[model samples]
Target: MNTPNQEAPAQNGKRRTRLIALGVAVLVGVGLYGSYWYLHARHFEETDDAYVASDLVQITSEVAGAVTAVFVDDTQHVERGQLLVQLDDADAQVSTAAAEAELARTVRQVRAVFSQADGLKAQINERQIALRSARADLQRRQKVAADGAVSAEELQHAKDQVAQLEAALNISQESLRTTQAQIADTRIETHPQVLAAAAKVREAGLALRRTRIVAPVSGTVARRGVQIGARIAPGAALMAVVPLDRVWVDANFKEVQLAGIRIGQPVELHSDLYGKDVNYHGKIAGLGAGSGAAFALLPAQNASGNWIKIVQRVPVRIALDPKELSDHPLRVGLSMTATVDLHDGSGPLVATQLRSEPQRVTINEQRDAEVQQQIARIIADNAGHAAL
Candidate 1:
């Protein structure tokens, strides 16, 4: 058996050994964490306060009408130019018909004016020939009367006829001038009256086409508020189209963490919905002009007596690769975690220029082409052929 004093010393030695081992473990842990911060963590900024965002294209009516049909519902995928809704088009159709008839009538009236001018020109030519004939006869009669072979009465009658022909020629020339003035320097298509009528026709056609609401972009429908038989007015919100392919991330970072952030930095993102299995790659597109608090509806009044300092966040826009987005789609307002690489500090903190072109441009395909065809048909039917 060992002595009591020897046992006490042995236990104290064991305690000292344990203390040494714990100290070494702590030192190693700290060193590893420090190395990690220096090599990687320092060159990046991360935030979980990010979300997918896209242009929420609102669908609104350009003309007021009662809803006749709802072609799409919530979450339906629609292509660009596909019809989404239809309004009662009876009034629009009647208006378009009236405009079309007016255009046709105007074309005929312009053609008639051209015809009248040509007729006046013909009358002028005929009057000139008559005057020439009358002058020749008068000269012959005067020559004969001087020789006593022609009677004075016959000679006087010839002179009177020549005078009458000259007066008639002058009247015809004046009439031709008046008619030419009405149709001067313009074709049937370019006439002011015809143009005015054509404008009416275009306006009416646009209204008629507006009755059929089409998708402005290829997107999934959301927030559909219209119903059948609902009377909607111009600018009323019917629904929204969210183009998933055009989505970007809006990451909000604290003010203290924004010093190294810059445009064009590479970003890696993870959506909570997809978890860490799927990673998204993007680049910083821009930085917000101000912090979120500054743009809030009820901004904090820091000047008041009850002021409390709070960390503010600024939004950073990150544009994703279109191909990646196509393969892995994202919806607006989805939560995401973003990590931006700040190794390259050679970019601007804010964009100094605007985009050279618009991101998107939507045109009403049906209204423009259909209206043109209708106008051409009206002109062809009324004026015998379409204007070149």
Candidate 2:
């Protein structure tokens, strides 16, 4: 219905309108993506410097012996107090027997001291009677000499008998003193000699217990170096214990990033091993003392270098739920990406105070009864002979 010129101009106008719409749509998309990058991008707290660490426990032998039996091999699972290795206990047995014998002999010696005290009392009584008789005989001899009924030499002999009796009495008193000294020695449980012997017994017992190398903690054994017949000594690193249950995550955040991060703040972590399928929730335990580079073996000599400024990261230890850790075990040194929701600003950014005592590892209540019973038995066995 319209002329060709009008129709051509209208069509051209429509084409121009469509092209403008397309350009606006493209711009809108670019703006949206830019906003997303600003909000959700990985803003790293700069560190080369991550380590896979745990409370590494190095197992060693306290008693010197040839390894008689290696019960658990490398990578074997071990429970707390379970036997891990056994040393040749023949030497320990001999030493322990010797200690027991010495302890028994000490007990008998102590008993003998009491017996000696009884003997001294009896000897003192007998000497008192003999001294009385000797005095009476001397008085009779002096009267006879005065009357000239007995010779002077005979009187002198009687006087000498009295003097000899007195000397014997003094010797008996000295004997009583020596016995009393022996009793005093027996009463001292903490005497140097007794203590030395008791210490040997304790040492021998400890050595005997150590022959059966029980696991100190429940964990998986790794890097075991000892085998049957290997002679081991004190402090020789034989293996390591890997505790998957007590694993904790260390999040390194930048100084600027620390503004929102605080103790007790809620956090969400995702590990590369488990991915986003399992989300680990945690709370900020505390921030590290210094930056990672500060603790380096050879710290940067920033004084003389070409001054290039770099941001530093400090490690923030995050504590995870034990239930979650138990459900899914995480190995030490696994890579993880963490995010802290800084919504709650209730706690301090840096802890101003510290605890006076160490936080106790929860006591194992299951073994309480058994331990009490064992202690009672030991007290009963050592009661009559030794007090403790």
For each candidate in turn, the TM-score is 0.93, 0.72
Candidate 2 displacement at residue 355 in angstroms: 6.4
TM-score attained by model 2:
0.72
* Candidate 2, residue 311: how far the Cα is off, in Å: 2.2
Clashes of each: 0, 1
Top-lDDT structure, candidate number: 1
Q: Give a tens-digit lDDT track for model 2, residues 128-147.
A: 89889988988988877878
What lDDT score belongs to each candidate, Candidate 1 first? 0.90, 0.73
**Candidate 1 to truth, TM:** 0.93
lDDT of prediction 1: 0.90
